[model samples]
Target: MKWRKEEQTPPPMEESAVPDTGWATTSMSTGAMANWTAVVRWSAWGLLLAGPLLGGWALASARTPVTVPTRAEAPRAQPASSDAVAPAGFAELYVAAYVKAGDSDADTEELSAYYPAARSMSWSGEGGAERAESASAVQVRQVSAGYWSVTVAARITSSSKNADSGRVRYFQVPVRAAGGRGASGWTAAALPAEVASPTSSKGVAPELSYGSAHAPLDSDPAVQTVRGFLAAYLTGGGELDRYLSPGTTLHAVRPAPYTAVSVTQIAEHGQGPAEGAEAQVPPDGVQRRLLVDVEGDGKHTGSRPMSYAIELRARDGRWEVAALEAAPALAAPGTKSNSEEGQGS
Candidate 1:
C-alpha cells in the first residue's frame, strides 16, 4: 500500500547561447571594447602631440635666466677719533714753532717741518734766516676749531757794528691745523706781523722796596673753601657745582686732560703791588687775591710746579672763585707779569 515512486527531475544544461545584434562572436566586439579602442587611439595621438609641447616647455625653462639673490656690499669704516675738533695743546705747539724774532737756516729748517713745504719756503725766505739772541713769552689762543692766533715776544740784535741794542717786540701770527699731502697735524697757516714793538728805556730804572712777609691764610673759612674747590677742580675729583657760581666759566680754568694737581701753599696778598707801596686794605665783602702753589702730574706734561693767583668772594654764606691767573716772578724793565706766559711756560 506504499505510494507510487516519486518522479525524477533532470539538471540544467551546462552551455548556453548569448544573444547578439549585428556583432562578432568574440567578447571584444561589444560597445565597451569599441570605447576602449577609441580611447587607446586618442591616448596615442595625445602622447605624440604632447611630447613636443613638453620638450619645448623644458627647453624654454632651461634657456630662461635665473635671478639669484645677492647681498649688498658693506660700508667702509672710519677712525675712532675722527671728530673735527682739534686736539689739546695743538695751538700752543703751533705758536712755539711758527712765531719767533730771528732764526738761523738750521732753526728755520727745523721750524719748517711744522708747516707745508710751500708755506715753509715762504716762511724761510721772509726774515726767518736772521739769527736772534733770544725769543721768549709765546702766547696762543684758539680762535676756532682748526684756527689759532699766536703772540710772541722776542729780542733781535742787528748784525751791523753800529746798530743799536735790540728791543722787545710782540708779533702776532695766525695758524691752522693742516691735513695736506706734505704737512699734517699743526702747521703755520700764515706769516707773523708785529703787534707791539716798544723800545727799551734809556734812563736808570727805579728801585722797589720789599714788602713785609705775609703768612698763609689757610685758617680763614673762605680760604679753606677756595683750597678745597681748587683741589677738586684741578684733580677732576668731586663735583664742583656747589662751589662754582652759576654761569661760571669753570671749564676755562679746568686743568688739562689726565692731569692731577694738589694745592701746596696758599698765601694772602694785599690789594696793591707787593713792593714799593703801602698795602691798601680791601673793603669788607670785597674779593681777596691768593697766591697758590700747586704741583701737577700730567699724562703728556710730566710732573711740574705751578703757581696761580686766585681771587674769591663770599656769597650765600659760601666762598666761590671769581677769577684765576698764573703767576711767575720776572723782574725786568718793560716786563710785566702775564698769566698766559706763566701757564704756557
Candidate 2:
C-alpha cells in the first residue's frame, strides 16, 4: 500500500577550461612555411657544393706523406743469439772465411785444403750451411751439442759490411769455443793460393734449386737471377752467368756425379708464388709455382731412368728451374704405355 517514488540525477557536462599544467603552444603561418622551405633548399645546395670540395681535400690529405721521426745516430742491428736453436734444415757445418765463385761449399774442398788433418772433421745435422774461404784465421768449435761457435779475427773480406758494399769479399773465420778454451782447442788450417780441380761441366756441378717465391721474396731481383740459373741448369747447361744469384746455394748429390740428361712432365707443374704475377712458362714476368718431374739417365742405379726435383720459378721476366733435390728412378711403363706422348706431331 505505501509505494515510494525515487529521484534520478543527470550526467555532468565536459568542461572547456584550460588544464592546470603549464606549457607553450605555437602555430606556423604561410610565411613561416616559406622560410623553412628556403632554409632546406639552401642547406641542400650548400651540401652539394661542399661535397666535391670536401672529397678533394680528403684525397689530398690521404696522399700527403706522413712525417716519421729519424734516429740521430746510426741504428744498430741486433745479432742472433748464439744459444738459439739451430735451423731445422741445418745439415752440415764448415769453418771457412770466404765463399769463392769456383769453390765447392757442398764438399768443403776449400776448407779441407785449409785445415788439413789437424783434427777429425766430424759433422752432423743442425749446422747451417758453411762456405769455404781464405780468411786469415778461422776455427770452428762445438758450442752446444748441435751448435758450433765460429770465431774470426774480424777479417775485412768476409764481414757483412764488405759484402753489402759489393766488393770482392775475402774472409777468415775465427774459431771460438764456449769455454775459455784457448787457441789449443782451435784447429789450424792452411790456405791454398788457387782453387783446385774446378768443375767446368754442368753435368757434375752443384745446382741451385728453388721452391716458389712469394711477395717480398720472389720480387727480389736476386731471386729472379737464381731462377734463371736453374733454367739453364735443367737443359744440361746454358749460360750459368746469366742466372746465378750472388748468394745462390750449391747442392751436392752423393754416389758421384748428378747428371740431368732431360727433364720431362713439365706440363704436370702447378702454380706457386715464385712467379711474378704471371702464368707458368710466360715469356716475361714471374711464375708462381712449378711441379717438375725430371727424367735422365746417369750413373744412378734403379729399375728405370733417374729423375730429380727440378723446381722452377718465374720472376724478373723469365722462367727458371730452381731446385734439383735428387730424382728417383723411373719405373717401367708396366701396364701403361707412352701412347700419351705423341700429339699433333
Clashes per candidate (backbone, < 3 Å): 0, 30
> What tens-digit string does per-residue lDDT give for candidate 2 at 99-209?
332323443444453354423444343222333333332334564553443334222233344333332222333232223232223323332233222223356422222
Question: What tens digits encode model 1's per-residue C-alpha lDDT throughout 1-345?
Answer: 888999888886545445656656555545788798899999999999999999878878896766576977686443223155443344344344554423356546666665445323533334442334556546767788767776666565545444544765576766666645333455666655668644344765442111222443444555566656766677776666666655566653455443577666654553233333222333335565666777778787886787677777656655677766555223355643343233467
Task: List candidate 2 segments past 4 Å from native.
Answer: 1-238, 241-260, 264-283, 299-318, 321-345
Those runs of model 1 whose alpha carbons end farther than 4 Å from true positions after fitting are: 1-218, 252-259, 271-284, 299-302, 326-345
Q: What is the Å distance of residue 139 in model 2 from its true position?
A: 22
How does each model score on TM-score? Answer: 0.33, 0.22
Model 1 per-residue lDDT at 200:
47
- Backbone clash pairs for candidate 1 read none
lDDT at 201 for candidate 2?
Answer: 34
